[model samples]
Target chain A: MSLSESTSRRRKKRANGVEFTAKEFKRQWILIAIAAVYVIYGIIFYYLPLAGWIMAFQNYKYKTGITGSKFVGLAKFQFLFSDAKFLQVIRNTFCMGALNLIFSTVMAIVFAILLNEIKNIWGKKIVQTISYLPHFLSWIVVCGLVHDALSSTGIINELLVKFGIIDSPFQFFASKPWFWPLVVLTNLWKETGWNAIIYLAAITSIDPALYESASIDGAGRFQKMWYVTLPSIRPTIMILLLMNIGNVLNAGFELQYILGNGVIQSVSRTIDIYVLDWAINGRNMDFSLGTAAGIFKTLVALILIVAGNTIAKKTGDERLF
Target chain B: MSINTMKPKKKKMATEDLIFTIFNTTIMVLFTIVTLYPILNTLAISFNEGSDAVRGGIHLLPRVFSLKSYKTVIKTEGIITGAKITVLRTVIGTLSSLIANALLSFILSRKRFLFKSGLSLFWIITMYANGGLIPTMVLFRSLNLIGTFWVYVIPGMVSAFNVMVMRTYMAGIPDSLEESAQLEGAGYMTVFLKIISPLCKPVYATIALFVAVYHWNSWFDAMLYNRTNTKYTTLQYELQKLLASVTAQGQGGGGGAASQTDATVATVIPITIRSAATILTMAPIIALYPFLQRYFVTGLTIGGVKE
Candidate 1:
C-alpha cells in the first residue's frame, strides 16, 4: 500500500465524507461497486439528460412528461430568433463549419506533407493503407459513395465530360451552389487518411537531427520541410487548431442528414438538422422548439470549448482540457 | 568534413533530390488513386448489370458481370434483417464497450482512487456537454430506451473519450505493478482480473479498435432510436433506406439511368442495389482492415494526444 501511503490514505478518506469506517467499508465495497456502475451509468445516461434541459423551459408535452410541461420562459428562445429557418440554420452551420475547418485542415496538412516525401517504405505503407479507406465508410456508406461519385454518369461526371470541363453533366446533388463545396469535398474524402494520422505522427517525431541540421544548413527537401518540419509541428498545429475551433458547431450530422434534398434544402440544414426538425422529425412535435435548438447547440458548444480553451491558454498552445 | 567540400554538395543534392522524388512519388500515386476510387467504384458497380449499372460508365472492372446485385443484396428481407442487426450490434457493441471501457478505465487508473477527482468530473461533463437532440430524445423517451435492443447496447456504454483513453493507458502502468498486486493479497477485482487486465493488452487492442469502429459505423442510432423498428434495423439503417430511395428516384427522374426507363422506376432500389448495399456495408471494414491497421495507428495517436 505504498504508493505514497495509498495517496495519503486517499487524502484522509476524501476528507471524511459519508464517514465510511468498517475498515473503510472492507476495502472500498468492491471499489464502490465498480465506481457505482459508472456513476449509475452517469446518472442514468449522462445526468438524466441534463434533466431534459427542463424541456427547454417547458411548453413541452408528450403526454405531460417533464413534470407536466408548460413553463415557456424564453418562449423557446423567442421562436429561435424569430425563425427565418433559424437563420438558414445558422448559415448552414457556419458555412459548413468554416468550409470543414478550412478544407479539412488544408487537406490533412497537405496529405501529411506529401505523404512525408515518400522515399518508398513500401510506398509509404501502401499510400498510408489506401488513405484510411474512406475512414471506415458509413455516413450511410459515405452517402452511398457521395451519390455514386456525383452521378450524372459518375466518376465526377466521367472526368468532367472527358476534360471538356462541362458541356454537360454537373447536377452534383441538384446544385445549391454545389452545397458548400460538396460538404468540403465530402470532408476531404472521409477525413484525409484519418486526418493525416496526427500530422503523420507529428511528422515522424521530427528530430532526424532536425533533418540533419536542415541539410547542413543548405536546407533542401522543401527547405527541410520549411525550416525543419514546420517548426516541429507548431504545437501540433495549435492543438489541432484548438480542436478545430471547438468543432465550429459540429458541421455535420450524417453529412447534412444524408445529403439533404428538396434541391439542397436551403444549403442543407445543420444545427443537428435544426434539432431533428424541431424535435423528432417535424409536423410540430416541437419538444420545446427542439429543446430550444438543442440548448443553442449545447451553449455554443460550451462556448466554443471554453473560448477555444481560453485562446489555447492565452496562446501558449497545447490546451484542450 | 571535406571530401572536396562534400563532392559538390553531393552533386547539388542529387539534382534537387531527383526533383523532389519525382514530385513526391507523383503525389503519393495520385493520392492512392483518389483514395481507391470510391471503394473501387463501389466494387465495379456491385458487379454491374443492375440494368447495366444504370447506363453510366462503370469504372474499375465489371462492365457486364452480374451477381444481380448480390442476389438483390441476398434476397432482401430488409437486407437480411439489416444483416442480423448489424452482426448483432457489431458483436455486442464491441464486447460491451470493451468491458465497459476497461472497467471504467480500471476505476479511473487508481493511484489512490477516492472518487478520482470527483469521478473525473463526472465523466468529463460528458465530453463537452450533451442533452442535445431534444433532451436526448426526451431522455430516450423516458428511459424506455425507445424501440429497444437496449437502444444499441445501452447509450454507447461509457465514453468520456473512452474514459480518457483507458485512463491515459491505465496511468502508464508501473505503480509498482499495482503495488505488487496489493502485497499479494490482491483485491480490486483481483488486480483488475490478474494484474491490470494483462497489462491492458495494448490498451485492449486500442479500445477494441475503437469500439469495433464505433459499432460498425453506427447508423444514427438506428436512425434515431429504431425509427419504426423493423426489429432494431441497422445495416447502416438499411443503407439509409437505400439511399433515400435512390435520392427520390434521382430527383424525380432526371437521371439514375433516366429513372429506370420509367415503369414506375422499374420497382426502384437500383444502382445495383445501392452497389450491393455499398459492398455489404464496407465488407467487414475491408476484411478487418489489415488486422485492425496496427491498432488504429496506435488508436489515433492515443486519442489525439489528450493529457
Candidate 2:
C-alpha cells in the first residue's frame, strides 16, 4: 500500500508543482495539528498565568480581581525591600544557597576523584549505588532520617555523649547557629554522589593516553590525577557550576519546609517560602506582596542564568544557552 | 630509563599504589556506611517496639521486634486513602505525560516540521520562566482545576524539561529509519508509535522512571491544590502531616519525655509509626531502584550532557 502511494506521490511531484506543494502542505499540517495541542496547553498553563504578574503592581484583592484592583506602582516592591522579615529571608536564602552550592560542588568533585581511584569494579559500583539512594528519596523522608539521627535520644547525640564529647545530648535542630551547616550537610549528603556521576563520566571520557604520558613523565597517581584528570574535566565543572549558580535561588523549598519549625523558621525560610506565606497562607494572604516577591525571584534567576551563560561563553565555549 | 620495563621504579610505585588503594577503599567503605546507616537505622527503629525505640539504642538491628508500628500505619484511614490516590496518580500521570511528551517531542524532533523551532523556542522559555506561585494557583482556580484530581495529572502533563529531554533523544535516532517507515506509507502517528517508540525504549524507561518517581514522591501539589479536598490527598502529604505532628510532639515534650510513659505515647503516633509509614511510602521506589540505576545514567547523559 505504501509503495503505491509513494509511486503516486512521485508521479504527482513530476506532474505539477502546485499539487506537490498542496500534498506537502497537508503532510506538514498534520504535524502542526499535533503540535497545536501542547502549544495551546502551554499558553493556557504556562504563558497565560504570566498575565497575573499585573497583580504585582496592584493592591490585589479577591473581591476586585486583577483588573479591578487599584494600581499601586512600585509600592509592593518597596514594601518588600523595606520589610525586615523579607530582608532576613533574602539573606537566609542566599547564605543557604551559597553554602549548598560551594560544599556540594567541592565534595562531589572530591568524591568522584577518590571513587575513580578505586580499582575494584564491584566495590565501586556498590558504593556508587548506595550513595545515589538518598538522591532518589523524598526530602520528607530524608528529613525524617536527619531528625531521627539528630534527636536528643538519637544516634548522633548518643555517640557524642558516649564518647565524652558532651555531657548531655545537644539540640542540633533547636539552635540558630546549626541551621546553615545542617542545610549544607543535608544537601551534600543527598547530592554529592548524584552530582559526581557527571564528573566521573568526564574522567572516564578523558584520553587514557594523557595519563600514560603523565606516567611516563614520572607522575605518580596523585600527580596524574591533579594534572590530567582535573584539567580534562574543567569544562564539565564550569558548566555545572554555572547551571547551579542559575538555580541558587532554589536553595531548596521542600527540605526547608519539611524540616523547619517555629524555632528555626527565621533561618530556614527561603524566598519561595516567603511567596507561599504571603500568597497561600490564610492569615497572611497578600496577593500583591507575594507576586512582587515572586517577580523579584524570577527576574534575579533569569539575570543570573543569562549572566552565567555569558560568562561561560566568554571564558570558554561551554555556554548552556 | 624508560619506565615501562623498570623493575625497581615499578616496585617503588607499587608500594605507594597499594597504600593509595587501601586509603581509597577505606574512604569508600566509610562513605557507603554513612549513606546507608540512616536508612537501615530507620528500618530497625520501625520494627523495634515503639516504646523501646524511644530509648534510642537501636542501630542496625531491632532489639525487640514488633510489627505494631506497621499495623498502626496500615490501619490509618488517611494513609490507606493516600496510598490509593498515590498509586492512581503514578500510573495515570506517568502514562499520560509519557504519551503527551513523546508525541510533542516526536513532532519537534522531525527535520521537516514547520513549527519545529517556533514550538521548541516556546517550550524552552517555559523551562526558564514561570508565573510563580500565586498566579499559577490563580490560573488553576479560574480553570476549576483547584481541588480536583486532574490538577495532579494535567498541569504537569507537558513539562518543557521532559519534552526537551525526549526531543534530544529522538533527534539522535537515525532519520533513515523514519524515512523508510514513511516510504512504507506509515503516517506520522504510526511512525511514532511503531518505529520511533520501540527504538526509544531506553529513553522511555528513563523517562518513565523519572515521571513515575516524581508522581509517587510529589506531596506539595496535594498540599497546595487539593489541601481541602480529602479525596485527593497523597501518601507523601499524609506522611508530611504525620511527621509534623510527631515533631511537634517531640518538641513540646522535650524529646522523649512523653515517650517515658508507654501509656502517654500510645495515644500519639510515635517515631516508630513515622518510620514504618516512611518505609511504606518509599518501598515502591526502592523496589524499582535497580531499573532506575540501570537506565538513568545512560539516559541522562544522552539527554542532558549533549545539550
Highest-DockQ candidate? 2
- On residues A1-321, what C-alpha lDDT tens digit does candidate 1 reach at each position? 112333554576567463546776677678778788788888888778878888888788788788887797998899789989888888889778988988888789888988887766887888898888788777778878888888889998889889998999888887778778888898898888888888888898887987887677777788777877888898887778776776788866778767767656777777777777666543567878877887787788778877887887897776765
- Model 1 misses residue A123 by how many Å? 17
Candidate 2 docking classification: acceptable
Q: What are the clashing pairs of model 1?
A: none
lDDT score, candidate 1 = 0.77
lDDT tens per residue, model 1, B179-243: 88788888888888888889888878887777877787787777677877888887877777776
* Clash count of each predicted structure: 0, 0
How far out, in Å, is residue B284 in model 2? 1.0
Interface RMSDs of all predictions? 13.7, 8.6
Model 2, runs deviating above 4 Å: A1-23, B1-11, B252-268
Score chain B of each candidate by TM-score: 0.39, 0.91
